[model samples]
Target: MNKHLIVVTAALLMAALAACPACLAQTAPKRSAPEERQEQKDARAARITERIELVIARFDNNKERHVAAYNAAKARLKEAITELAEKGYDVTRLTADLQAWDGMFVKFAQDYATLINLLRTAEQYAPYESQGQFAAAIQQARAQLVTVRQDALDIRHYYQTVIRPDLQALKDQNPSSSPASSGT
Candidate 1:
């Protein structure tokens, strides 16, 4: 009877290990596989966000740097909304305001990406190309910067005005929801 119990326990352990590949490792992981994976994802996101923020902070009074900063800001916006999008939440469908904001964000991203590419290509070809061409490219880049700045401002305003109110309302609805454990 004892031998039968031992064999049964060993079989269950093997099955558990097989089911969870991480359990097969020589050393036990501090977190379960899912938790570890989540942590890794969070770390990656943090790194990307930090990189974007660094670009923003280091932006100088130059067209190239400004374009880089705007591009980085676009990346930050994309990353900020990725989890919400991945969760299959239709934020744009929730309200007219949300839909407008979503459209603005998308348009801003597209414009920034195009502008960044144009600026980079111009810079690359500037030395081999004519001065007039380079100057015209700079003028084009500077002209686009105004709209890009406005897009960023609009995004910031939308987040502060619309999203915060909705979030506060949600928090108010849930009495037992603690801010510390919100995992936000």
Candidate 2:
């Protein structure tokens, strides 16, 4: 009986040791250095481009919905600006943000454009390949859209908490310089 117990314990220990590497491997984070860099670049670009587009949309149509959207987008823009600033990028030049943002914007826009085209083409021919592509594109687009919306919220908060107060202070300091001061 003593010998049997010893043998069973040794076998169990061996089994656990053999499984350790696989367990460790499964739990480990898999992001490679290049992948991490690319993800950062992509996120940064997405932030800037989405904000700019939202801003443009606001100005293009001054509806209440657009105004709200603009505010939200501005909040995201400010967050991205803060992030880039922290990342040691001089955001003073719109060119830097523009370049990054433009690339991401074009990528996402083209993806959506392709999805639309696929949808139209699928309707005409009913091919499985086109249908599958369209469905996948739509799923990816929806996920991306959620990220874009969250970024917009961050921009709106930044505008409200930081930009608005500064502007208000400037106005207060220069109250007498405005024609509205006459109460006409």
Candidate 3:
């Protein structure tokens, strides 16, 4: 009888321990700090880059529709910068930097458009030597466009890594100062 009672007591104690919240909590795996943060930053940057690239690709793929779309997207980006400036973000400095970048991108796009137009013209005219020249021009424009695209990507990456983190830290430091948080 004494042995049976001891056995039952041990079983009950084990059962109680299994039911504890602390045991459940301790069973879950811990997350690494840096890994989690890097994942979050990568995801955010990917989203922004994807949106910008999609618009650019849409413009590239559909020549007939692209002019309107490209203009609209550019206008929207400009408006966004203006809005950010109005909200007390450093518009002047950022705009100056972006304008320089924009000029490069515009030149690339113009060259690409000219190349495409040349190709179309060559195809319609079907002159042998002109075809070769048009082909060479198209290839050159494509290479330039690739470089411009890479530059834009680099700028975006910099914005994500340097600009965004600083802005986020500022927002965190002064929660009430942010327009979004202030409800103003």
Provide TM-scores for the models.
0.38, 0.28, 0.36
Residues 34-142 of candidate 3 have per-residue lDDT tens digits of 8897778667645644554565466577544444554564566567566664565544444554465456456656665665554344333322334476456446646
Identify the candidate with maximal lDDT: 1
Per-residue CA lDDT of model 1 for 1-184, tens digit only, reads 9999999999999888787866456566467898887778667645644654454444333435545664575455444344443444333322444456667767776777666654654554323235576567656767776777787788778768876576444333423322212112
Query: What lDDT is reached at residue 23 by model 1?
Result: 44
Ranking by lDDT: 1, 3, 2
lDDT of 3: 0.55
lDDT of 2 by residue, 1-184 (tens): 9999999999999999999999999899889998998788667645644654564455335334644555565457656556544544444443334344334444544444444443333333322334475356445546655554544454445556654554344333322322221110
Residue 177 local lDDT, model 2 = 26
Per-residue error for 38 in candidate 1, Å, reads 56
Better by TM-score, candidate 2 or 1: 1
Collision pairs in model 2: 72-152, 74-155, 75-154, 75-155, 75-156, 76-154, 76-155
| Candidate with the larger lDDT of 1 and 3 | 1
In model 2, which regions exceed 4 Å deviation?
1-64, 67-131, 171-184
TM-score of 2: 0.28
